[model samples]
Target chain A: MIHPLAVSHDFGVWVGALLTLMVFSFLYRDNPFYKFAEHVFVGVSAAYWMVIGFWTTLWPRVIVPLIPEASRIVSSDTPLPERDLSAVVPAVLGLMMLSRLVPRLSGLARWPTAFVLGTTAGYAVVRYVRSDFMHQIQATIGDGVLIPAAGGGWNVAESLAALVTLSGTIFGLIYFMNTRRGGTVTTPAARIGLLVLMVTFGASFGSAVMARISLLVGRLQELLGDWLGLL
Target chain B: MKRPTPQILLTGVALILVVAAFMAPPGDGSSGGFAGAVTYADRHFSSWFGILAVFAFLLGGASLLRTHGRRVRERKADWHYSAVTLVSFLAVLIVGFLKLGGPPGLTGDPTDASSWLTTIFDSVLSPLHATLYSLLAFYVASASYRAFRARSLETSVLLGAALIVLLGRIPVGVTLFRFDSLSLWLLKVPNTAGQRALMIGVALGVVALAVRMVLGLERGRGGDGS
Candidate 1:
C-alpha cells in the first residue's frame, strides 16, 4: 500500500541510525563498524571540500567575470582596467593543479603551487614578525611587573607569580631555539625548560577539551530544539 | 643533476605574465582593451577548471569503490565492514545524484524535507559527526588531571595561575568566591603574556620553514630522502 520512495526513506533513516550507533560504539571498544564509518567520513569530507573549492573559489573568482556582461567597468576610481587575457594565467595555473593526477604532468603543477606557497609564506612571515614577536616582547616587558599596593608591603604572591611566568616564557623559547648548543636533556636548565613546555602543553590540552565540550553542548541543544521539539 | 628546464620555464612564464598584467598601459575602452581580454580569458579558464574539478569527484568515488571492493572480494576477515562501507557510500551517492524523492517535477527544490538525501544527511551524518567529536571531553579531563601537577616552585606558580583562570571562566567560580578581579588578572596578564611569547616563537619557526620551502631546500615531496 505504501509508495516505493517512502520505503527508501525509511530504509535510509534506519541505515543512518545504524551508522551513528556504530560510530558511538567506539567509546566502548574499537570495532569494524567504527573503522568503516571513519573511512567513509574521510572520503566524503575530501569530496565535499574539492567540490566547494571549485564552486566557491574557482567559479566565482575566476570564471563569472570572464562573461562579457559580468565584466566590471573601469572608471577614474577603479584601480585597474578590465583585461580578457588576465584570466588565462590563473586558468593555466588551475589546470596545472590537475596535472598532479597525471604522473608525467604532475611536475607542471609545481609552478602554480609554488606561487601560492611563496605568497602565503611571505605574508605569514611579515604578519608573525610584527604581531607575534614584536608585540609579545613589548607586552611582556610593559606589564606583569609587580608594584606595591595602596596598603604598602610588596604584593609577594602577585610579584612572584609574574616573575616565574616571565622566566618560564624565556626558558621555553630558549628550549626551542635550534641554534642553541650545550643545553641537553640532562642539564638542569634544559630539564626546567622541558618541564615548562610540558605544563604549557597540558594547559593547551585542557583548554582544547573545554572548547570541544562547548561545541558538543551547542549541537545537543540544536538536536533537542529541532528533533525532540523540547525547546 | 638534470637542469631544472620545466621549473625554470614555468617560473619565467609566470613572471612575464605577472609583470605584463601589472605594467601594461591602461586604456579608455570599457571592455575592448588588453585588460578586458585578459579578464575574459581568466573567467573562461576558471569555469573550465571548476567543471573539471566537479567531474573529478567521480574519479575519487571510483577510487574509493575500487579500494573497498578489492577488500570485499579478497574475503578479508573484516570484509563485512567493507561491505557496510560500500553500501552506505553507494546509498548516499545514489540518493544525492539521482535526487531520489526530490520534488515531483524537475525544479531542483532542495527545501523538500521529503527528499531522501536531505532526510538521511540531516538526521544521520550530521549528528554522527557531532557525537564523535564530543567523545574528546572525557579523554581531555583524564589527561589534564594527570598532567597538571606542581612538583617545583615554578610548577606551583604555573598550576596556581591555571587554577585561577579555569575557575574564572566558569560561572561556579564567580558565584562561590566572587573573585572576578583575581580571575581577570590571571587571564589578562599571565595568560596573554604566555600566549604572545609562544606565538612569536611559532611565527619565527614558520618564516624559516617557508623560506626553506620556497628555495626548494625543503623538498617535502614524498618518499624517504635518499
Candidate 2:
C-alpha cells in the first residue's frame, strides 16, 4: 500500500532538485530561470516565517495563557493561575519587533534591541575570559614537552611540531591585537603572526570548498540512484 | 514638545514581557505552561512557515516576469540571457506545478521519474550549483599565496609552524617527511587549544553583541549599514 506522505515527499524531492538546478544555472550565466527560483525561495521563506511566527510564537504563548483553565481544587472559583507574567515577557519584546513595520513607531524597537545586545555582550565577556585567554595559555603547554622520555622513545618531530603549533598560535593571536606602540605597520613578531593567519584562512577555505563538493557529490549520487535508477 | 506615546508603550511592553519570560517557572518537561508553549512553537513553526512560503512563490514569479519581460521587450543588451532565464524559469514552474510527465496512472504524483522538471533539475541545476561552489578552491589557493608571507621574526616563526601543520595534514606531506606522529600531536594538542581559545572569544563576542541588541543601545542589528 502506498503511504500518503510518500506521495508528497516524492513531489518535494523532485521540486527541490529542480530548484537546486535552477540556482546552479547562474554558473553558465545569470538568467530568468535562476531569478524565478531565487524569488520563489525568498517568497516562500518569508510566508513560512509569518505562519510559523503566528502559530508557534504568538497563539500558544500569548493566547492560551490569557484563557482561564478549570481549577483542580474543589470550592475554588479561580482558574489555574494564569501563566506567570514573566513567561509572556519575551513575547512582548518580540512583538516590539513588529514596531519596525510602522514608520512612526519603529523607534520603539530599540529597547528590545538594546536588551538583546546588552545580554549578548555580557555573555561574551564571561565566556571569552575562560575560553580565549586562560584555556589558550594552558593549552600551549603539553605533556610531551614537560615529561622526560622514560621508554627511550622520545619523538623529536612530534615535539617540534607541537612547539611550532604553540608558537604559531601565539603569533596569530598577537597579529590580531589592536594595540601598537607606534605608527609602524610592520613589526617582526606581527609579520610572523600575519603569515600564520594567512595559512589558517587558506586551510579553512580549502576545507570549506571540499565540504561543498562532497555535499554535491552526495546529491548527485542520490539523483543517480533514486531518480534515474541507474545504480 | 511632543511625546511619543506609542514608542513609550511599546518599550514598556517589551520590558515587562522580557522580565516575565525570565521569571516564569522552568516548566515541567512537555507538560508545564511555559516549557510546553516553547516546545509547541519550535515543533510547528517551521512547517507552518513552509506552507506560507509556497504561496509567496506566486509573488516571486510575478515579480520575475515583470522585471525580465520588460528587459526582453526593450531589446536590452544581454536580452538573450534574460530570455533564456525566463524560458527556463517558466518551463520548470509549469512542469513542476502542473505535474507534467507525472506517473501515468497516478493523479498527483509529480515526483515520478518521468517528470520533466525532475529530469531537468537533476541533470542541469545540481551540477551547476556544485561547480560554482567548487570555484572556492581556486580562490582559496590564490588568496593563500597572496596573503601568506613572512616579513618579520614572529611571521617567520608563524610560517614555520604553519608549514609543519600543512605538511602534517596531507598523505604526501606525512609520507615524504615521515612526520605522521608529529602532525597528529600538532593537531590534537595545539590545534585544540587554539580552537578552544577562538571559540571562547567568539562566544564572548556573541554574548556582548546579543546583550547590546537586547538593551536597545546598539543600532543597525549588527549589519554593515543603518
Fnat values, one per model, are 0.21, 0.08
The candidate that achieves the highest DockQ relative to the unseen native structure: 1
Q: In terms of lDDT, which candidate is strongest?
A: 1
Per-residue CA lDDT of model 1 for A1-231, tens digit only, reads 632332223454455556566676787899877887776665454444443454445544556445443322211333433445545656666667666666798676555555454444444555676778877787666666685666998788667767766776776666566324654454465556665665554455546666778866756565444333455
Worst 10 residues of 2 chain B by lDDT: B46-55
Q: Residue A47 CA error for candidate 1 (Å)? A: 3.2
**Model 2: per-residue lDDT, tens digit, A50-169?**
333433444445444543342221114444666644435555555555565557986655545444433334334444555665565666764535333566766675576567667776
TM-scores for chain B, in order? Answer: 0.65, 0.64
TM per candidate comes to 0.63, 0.55
Cα displacement (Å) at residue B194, model 2: 5.8
Provide the TM-score of chain A alone for each candidate, in the order shown: 0.67, 0.75
